[model samples]
Target: MVRKLLPPLASGFLFGMGLTISGMTDPGRVRGFLDIFGDWDPTLAFVMGGAVVVMAIAWRVQARMVKPVFGERFSLPDRTDLDPRLLAGAAVFGVGWGVAGLCPGPAVASLALSPVYAAPFVAAMLVGMLLQKLTMERKVSNP
Candidate 1:
């Protein structure tokens, strides 16, 4: 159990810490990044770039490995086709991120600092996720 859970826990802890340290937990900072037309912040770009570089290396490592060290198999997305659903979801996510300045990672981390603000965002996110799951399940069953 510990072997299965520890890597994910560690990764999530590191992710949360990175988000907090990068000022992503601050709505003002995130909003500033989104405000490219106005007083835009460039720090998030650097943060994003760093993440991309790290993930690129991780991907390369994964390609070399037969399976994850902790898992029997690596569960990864297999879909390569771009569809309307993907575009629509991206647009919705972008709008939500811009308006709220709170994506899931930062919002969850903010629960430690400001439950009053994070609680509603987290609740809404959960509801949205549940709705998506139901929609997907219905489509799969009907198809």
Candidate 2:
């Protein structure tokens, strides 16, 4: 259990550090990025670009590896084609991000800095996840 938890906890810490360093832990900073016509900030784009670059490199490394440290092998998503569900989810996520200015990772990190807004943001996120699970369960049962 300790072995399983360590890597994820370490990764979360690093992710949180990145958010803090990039000023993404601040809702105001995120809101500024969302505001295109008024006091817009482009920092989030750079952060995202950097993340993409890192993910590209990491994916390459993972592909070459025979197995992961804990798991037998990585089970990546098989779907390469975009569908309506994917597009709809992206749109909903974008809208939520724009309105809340706090995605899951950063919102959890913001808690360390005592951001009161993070509580409700995190609560809503959890509720959304639960709803998605319930809907998926219903679909599976119906099908």
Candidate 3:
């Protein structure tokens, strides 16, 4: 149980700490990054680039490994094709991120740092997720 939980817990903790330290928890900072036509902040680019680099290395390591360092099997996304649902979801996510300046990761981390402000965002996010699930279920059932 501890083994199963510890890796995820530690990873999340480290990710949250990184977000907080990188000023990603600050909506103003994120908004500034989104403001490419105006006072654009490039810091988030560096953060994202660093993440990409890290993930690239991780992917390379995974390619050589038979199984994950902490799991029964490496659960991976099987889909390689794009659909309307995927495109729409990505669009909605981008719009929401631009408007709110807080993606799920920073919003979740902000729960511990600034719950007063984070609560509504988190609640709405959960509601949105539930709605999406139900919509998808209905579509599948009807089709």
Strongest candidate by TM-score? 3
| Model 2: worst 10 consecutive residues (lDDT sum) | 77-86
Off by over 4 Å in 3: 78-81
Every model: Cα RMSD to truth: 1.7, 1.9, 1.6
Clashes of each: 0, 0, 0
The global C-alpha lDDT for each of the candidates, from Candidate 1 onward, is: 0.92, 0.89, 0.93
lDDT score of residue 24 within candidate 1: 92
Give the RMSD in angstroms, all C-alphas superposed, for model 2: 1.9
Highest-lDDT candidate? 3
Candidate 1: lDDT over CA atoms? 0.92
lDDT of candidate 2 over 4-47, digit per residue (tens)? 89998999999999999999988788999888999999999999
Cα lDDT tens digits, model 1, 57-133, are 99999999998898789989766656888889889888888999999999999999889998899999999999999
Candidate 1 vs 2: which has more TM-score? 1
